[model samples]
Target: MKPVRRRIRRHFGLTAKQVAVRSKRPWYFQWGITVLYVVFGYGIAYWQFAGAEDVHQKLRQTALENQTLHTKIIQVERQLQIEQAAQTNLAQQLNKVQDENMHIKQDLVFYKNITNAKRLAK
Candidate 1:
């Protein structure tokens, strides 16, 4: 009784030491919650980094494919231009050959008339 009086007097009329009145979680439970938070943070970070790398890889692949297609288009255009020039040259040659053929025919007819006239005179 004297000890209780001394404690009450020392604490200003209350108990000298504090005691928990409510239930608390165990130490292991608190540690488990902390570990779960850390693991969750690491998982989210890994996902972010991996997703960025995947996007970069896809972009590089697309760029490479586009470059290949562009090169093919340029080659085809050059071939088409070359074919068109060749066709034009052939058309010019054909026109020159037709003119020469007509001239030759006229000469043949003139020679025939001269020979017939000479025979008539004889």
Candidate 2:
């Protein structure tokens, strides 16, 4: 019984010591891991910055395109307004000409009736 207990204690003590030794790794290995982590972090930061810059450039391009389109739309709208105004003016002029033609036709009829009356009297 005593030998069995001693063997169990020795096994447990060796396990604890192994665990402690593994927990304390060499300084060079720890520094290498820290350097690798720093490099990886820097790489990630650079990748994010590059992506953001690309997005910014795209946004500027889109904004310029939008501004150009907006200006074109304004120009088109102004042209349409001018054309509509000209059409309205043309319609008014056409109405005035038709009214004048109607008046001339009435006068011609009156003159023909007067001439016919003079001929009948003779």
On lDDT, the leading prediction is: 1
The local distance difference test score of model 1 is 0.94
Among the numbered candidates, top TM-score falls to: 2
The TM-score values for the models, in the order shown, are 0.54, 0.58
TM value for model 1: 0.54
Q: Count the backbone clashes (under 3 Å) in each candidate.
A: 0, 0
lDDT of each: 0.94, 0.94
Candidate no. 2 TM-score: 0.58
